[model samples]
Target: MSVGLGLPIAAPEQLPTWARRADASPFSTLALLDRLVYANPEPLVTLATLVGTTERVRLQTEVLLAPLHRTALLAKQAATLDLLSGGRFTLGIGIGGRPDDYLAAGIEQRTRGRRLDDQMARMRRMWNGQPLGDEVGPVGPAPARPGGPEVLFGGFVPAVMNRVARWGDGFLGAALPPAHMDRLFRDVEAAWAKQGRAGRPRLVAQVNAALGPEETVAAARREAHAYYHPSPFADHVAEGILTTPRAVRDAVAAFRAIGADEVMLYCWAPDPEQVERMADAVF
Candidate 1:
């Protein structure tokens, strides 16, 4: 089973030791992205540095909201990162949940789904080095990989799932229920068949995990709420689905059985040492 780790680009004070321990172990990949656009210090530059220093680790954005920025600019930024990382970048994208983000960007959040679909198309064209409007032959300094890096779409809404099947290379399912995940995969496969695309859709699942003494479960729950309250699966926290390491591992196994290609463990601990301990427990 291939497993990955996801880290949030939040306050420096919020990064646990585990988040900082990029030097150890061999997980499938490391996904990094900020929840709030302006909260982090130079997100693109920081991500580039991480890619430059780390070998054999795939770098990804849990999701870089496209509607919040110009499609051309986003493509350029992603292409640069992909080039710097030797094609190690996987551009995970989505329409953001925060209305405030759109307001801050002076963009409206209406019709975000369709807008995202259009943006995806535009991004692919840009990455292919195709010039927009009235430009030269092709965009210079193409991404290290041909056709640019792989794109993973995030969100579990039915419309989002359909879009993933129609366009994205894969689906980044946020804490989805097991049964719904199965249905989503079926839809993706059906869409692929209808489009005459070969092979199955790549599915990535993210689960919140905390492993430690029983006394720590409450803290973990609070941390999870802080991070995932905006997501669809926020209610699962009370159901005891994401309270322990054992539970998280079982959930990963369950997702695998339901056709998930990879599971990215999202840890909630602010303590770096605890995060490392949890990684030891699962990885």
Candidate 2:
């Protein structure tokens, strides 16, 4: 199994340094978390900039809120990034849990699931060179990849598994324990078989880590609390933050043992050196 790194939210001036450090790391992919109501940079836009600095690592949004944007626009933006990144993009999408994000986008909260499904279908059509029935012709230039960028769906619901079976390249899991992930992988595999798809779907997992000194570990705990505060799972979130080399190794081993293709280590703090420390621990 391969290991990836998550790009933490940071000040504008600090982003370039973050990109350079991640570029230099032995990680396989660089992932991002999305939020319109939060302080982080837009995932696609941040990726657009990061591609200019890095040549090799792949990019993905750990869980970009798909229901929040116009489907066509999101499709175009994703295609553009995939092209610019030399086919190094995988779109990990979800109908976000935060009601505030739905409100901020002025979308009805209840329709999120259906909206995401429709969005995925429409985006796939756009990527497959299907015409929009307008003057622009097919959405071009085509993605750097042949059939467009890979799509991974996030969410632990059965409906989400259904979507994955139909339209996704894989499933994206966030901060889930090994047992939970084992069940999820089983369900996903079953869904694939039920759908008459040929093979098992790719699986990716994300875990939080703060791998430096005591001060950094404390701040990581605080950040974890703030990020998960609105959810019922908030308390359990801290239990997954791997702060030492052994913890990180064990977490990776456990996930990979359960059939994960990649495990992304998400840093809790904004400092680029935290990422460097993570490389030292993992690599």
Candidate 3:
């Protein structure tokens, strides 16, 4: 399985250097997290900048909240990124759990799931170059990939399976243990079979790691807790962070053994050196 790195939502000024480091590292992809009411750079914007800076690593949104934006616009943005990135992009989307983000985006919280479903359907049509009837031909600058960048769906419930079956190319499993990941993958595979999808959907998984001295690892735990503790799985997330090289090594092996196509190790600390630490541990 290929190993990838997730660029943390840190100071914007530091991102260029971080992106360069991740690109140069022995990693397969550079992923980003999305949030409207948080500290992260807008995933697409940050990714656009990296399109010119990084030559090899694939880019992903990690999980862009689709319900917050207009469907066609999001589709266009994704296609543009794919075009500019030489087809090295993946659109990972989900109906995120933060109601505050929805409120901030002027979206209705209760209808997000339905909204995401509709958005995915629309995006696929847009990517396929279908006409909108009122528009002047299909959306232009067709995706770098024929059908558009691969779409990966992420969420915490079985409802997500429906979207995966319809539009996604894979399942973007969250930061979870190998046992839980096993169950999640099985469910997604079952969903794909039930929907009669052509082949097995790709299986990608994520885990948080803070590889450095005690101080950096501690900060990683704090950041992980601050971001995840608002949910019901706070303790599980907090406890899952890999603090040592051995921890990172073990976690990667565990996820790969469970059949993950790629396992992304998200850095919780904002330090650029964290990339090297991770590379040292994994590469």
Candidate 4:
């Protein structure tokens, strides 16, 4: 199994150093989280800037909120990024829970699931060169990879499995214990087969991590806490933050044992050295 890393949410300015360091490392991919009501960078735009700076390592939005953006525009931006990045981009999406994002986007949170389902269809068609109308013609700049970048869905809900079956690309698991991830992945596999899909879905698991001095670890813990504030699950998320080399190694091994294709560690400590530190532990 391969391992990946997530850029820090608290520091956007460090991404250039962090992305370059990760690119030169053995990590298979680099990821970023999504937040509309928090102090975080927009994943797509942030990743787009790295396309020219890095040479290896795939780029991903660990889980970008899909319901808030215009489908056609998102399709264009993703295709452009994929093309520019030499087809090294993975689009991992989720129906976000933050009501503040919907409030900001002027979208209805209750309708997010339905909206994503419809948007997925339209975005796929747009990527495959389907025009909006006879008069509108096909969207400009065809995808670098045929049929566009691979799409992965993320969540703990049963309905998320349906999305995987319908799309048949992959599933991006949240930071949960191994048992929870195994159960969720098993359900996803069954749903995919029930839908008569040709092959199994790609399974990628994610976990939050921090490796540094005690002060740095505590600071990262506080960052994670603030990010998940008000949600009861915030405490649960905090508990899962892997703080040492053994913890990171054990997490990767657990996911690998369950047949995961990749383990994405969301490194919360913001430092360029953390990249080397994580790579040494994982690779």
Candidate 5:
């Protein structure tokens, strides 16, 4: 399986260094997280900043809350990023599970899934040279790839299966155990077949990791807890932290064995040293 590196969202200023290091290292992809009401930098904009700086690493939003943005605007932004990146971009999108984010975006969370469905349809049309019932054609430059950037869907709901089967190029299994990844991936595969999709969806899983001195590890855990606060997910994430070289190796092995196409090490520690530490642990 290909190994990828997630952005150290805890240290936004250091990302360019991390991005260059990840690209030059063994990491095949550079992933970023999105949150409007949080510390993580805005993913697409940050990623765009790296386009000329790195050549080979694929960029992903990890999971952009699709329902929070206007459909046409998102379609254009995504296409522009893909075009500039030489097609090294993936749009990992979802109906995010935070109510405060919804309130901040001034968008309701209750109908997010349905809105994403509509957004996907309209965005596809826009990418393929059709406007959203307007006078002009194509919203922006065509993506470097034929369609728009490959899209991956994220989230834990069964509704996600429908979205993947219908529109996603893959499933983004975020920070789940291999066992859970296996089951959800299988469910996605079954849905894909049921819907008569020509090929199976790509399976990309993530694991939160912090490999270094005790201080870095502790800080990573604290950051993780703060980000996933109040949700049972924080506890789940805590339980799954890979803090040692052996633990990181084992986690990657488990996901690879479970058929993940790629596994991104989601670093909680902001230290750029982690770029080499994680690479050393993995390969």
Candidate 6:
């Protein structure tokens, strides 16, 4: 199985250690709609440092909410990061869940789905070196990758799945249940087949996992709860999804059985050292 690490955007204090860690590949989780709010203003600089320091590890935006940001600017940032990272970049994107984010950005939350589609289309055009109408010409210093970094779409709803089938190169499902995953994979595969696409769609799922003696499992559940409780998956967690490593592993194995190509573990420890410790047990 291919392993990838998630960088904490919610906790900027952890980033320095996360960056300095030599054992794990760095994957930035860009869930914040506004860069000024959640990310350092100088993200490219941080990404460049990670690339220069690490030998085998790659850098990725675990996700950037597309609807809240301007398309052309987002394309430029992604392209620059890809160029700086020597093509070791993957553009993971999603339509964010918080309506407040769209409100703060002065974007209409009701129109976000359509906006995301248009934005994605525009981003692709910009990446292809096509001159947009007016003076907004081709982006300077093309991405190191020929076509640009791979675009991965994340979401679990039907609209999101349709978007993935139509435009995205991959699908990322967060905190998914295995049975639910089976249905999702079938839908995506069927869509791909209808479109006469040849290869299987890249499928990835992220789950919270904590490994330790039995005494620590409760603490792990609380950590996992902090993330899932206020989200759509809140009901699932209430149904006992994040209680233990065995529960998490069983869910992952079920996804693998149903053809999920990758599984990303979201570690919820307060300390980077604890995250590394958990990684050692799970990996």
**3 versus 5: better lDDT goes to:** 5
- The predicted structure with the larger TM-score, 3 or 4, is 4
Q: TM-score: which candidate is best?
A: 4
* lDDT, candidate 6, at 261: 77
Name the runs in model 2 displaced over 4 angstroms.
134-136
Give residue 238's lDDT in candidate 1 (0 to 100).
32
What's the lDDT for all of these models? 0.70, 0.85, 0.87, 0.89, 0.89, 0.64
> 1 or 6, which is superior by TM-score?
1
Error of 6 at 38 (Å): 6.8
TM-score of 1: 0.85
Local accuracy of candidate 1 as per-residue lDDT tens digits, 26-64? 567677655553454345555676765676667788877
lDDT of 2 by residue, 116-150 (tens): 88888888888988987777667766888776798
Clash total of candidate 4: 0
Error of 6 at 136 (Å): 2.8
Which clashing pairs does model 1 show?
Answer: 16-272, 17-272, 18-272
**Superposed model 4: Cα runs more than 4 Å off:** none
How does each model score on TM-score?
Answer: 0.85, 0.95, 0.95, 0.97, 0.97, 0.81
What is the per-residue lDDT of model 3 for residues 125-203, given as tens digits with 9 covering 90 to 100?
Answer: 7888987667546875689998889999997699887778878899999877889999999899999999999989999
lDDT of 6 by residue, 31-128 (tens): 21124233232344456556665555566555667777788888888888788767777777887777656777888889888999998787777888
Instruction: Report lDDT (Cα) of residue 210, candidate 3.
Output: 85
Q: Worst 10-residue stretch by lDDT in candidate 5?
A: 129-138
Worst 10 residues of 6 by lDDT: 28-37
lDDT of 3 at 90: 96
lDDT of 5: 0.89
